[model samples]
Target: YNIHPSEKLIQAFRKKPYQGCCPIQAEFLFIGLDANYAYDIEEQKIFPKVIEYHKDAISFWKKYNVHHPFLLDGYKGDGRKYHKEFSKIRLTCEDSSRISFIELLHLPTTGRNNLRNTDLDKNHLKYIHQAIVSQYTKAVFISDAVFRLMKKTSTFSWMQDAREIEGYSLKVFHETSPLIYKHLHFSTYGKFQAQKEKEMKAIHMIISKI
Candidate 1:
């Protein structure tokens, strides 16, 4: 009698779009993603999918002529965050083009009721840590940015690996820099959200501040 539902309930789980729903970060925050789940990037239509497997994505990025490798981290893995629930994409406009990195896995944004107390079981906690370590290694190897803003509230301090070195500053170097007021737009099924306007305005403010 649908005991399957109850059995699945007792087992551990990861939140999905079918669950409560995902909340995007505030308008001003930058976004980035890791490499593994890049296919999701195309499916989501967050941007045009770079083709030819690896070469095209890199080439499309280099097209802007602002090439620099940086470490990109996905989750802290300190029990404070769930890796699979928070898919991410990094956004930074440079040289007249928007730069992005696609990441998969993250904590659910839904409130406490959605979380399971068993999420902290030692095995579960270890798996989360392992995921973090693996992701961190890739980012470190590439020297991308961790996007610091996505870190869990406090379980562990989210720090970029020392090997990553310096990254681009939030402030644009040129007042007229193509990136200065570059607009990033988001749409859901051909319709735009009012939040997109706010994001644009906030970006302008950030540009003006720089």
Candidate 2:
């Protein structure tokens, strides 16, 4: 991973041997984990909001007239659309109902009005990337620097902060030890793992009770 790759760097990351019983976006959509669980949104492999928005049922282009012009843009909803009963990953756990690729705690980044072009002082690559990585990401006004960096690095690898949780009842995705280990890039195995197992068992008991 250290080598400065040729033009094929992105293609390299995208190419992974996938043979699962379930449908994975990684095969064609370039959605799947290089690691166990995703550390960042890009690694999670969820559909890019704007990318999917342009292709969805809405077409502002055909609807737009000269004077009256409008277009519905990317991921606009209560987040229930992506909340599939069965996505490749598990954001919402085994409800047999609220299945999804990754359990989203916040809104997608595309919905908000981020830094404007006039607001160039704060339009930095790292800043923008950080702003959009949140589960409740309002919007990502990607700056030219961000784009250039990706192109230059030939990598979309960005910094990601694991979601924090207040408790350990599978109450949150990133906080649960087993779930995190299963679905996130972090690890839970070590001396403290015993406590995590106990907590997981306790949660299972709670689920059975409920």
On TM-score, the candidate that comes out on top is 1
Candidate 2's residue-wise lDDT over 7-115, tens digit each? 2222322231211111121111112111121123332223343223223212312232110011123222322222221121221122222111210111122232232
Worst 10 residues of 2 by lDDT: 21-30
Q: Please give, for residues 64-126, the per-residue lDDT of candidate 1 as tens digits.
A: 332221112321222122212121122332311222222222322222122223232344333
Error of 1 at 138 (Å): 21
Model 2 segments beyond 4 Å from truth?
1-95, 98-186
lDDT of 2 at 126: 37
Whole-model lDDT, candidate 1? 0.26
Error of 2 at 127 (Å): 22
TM-score of 1: 0.25
Name the best candidate (by lDDT): 1
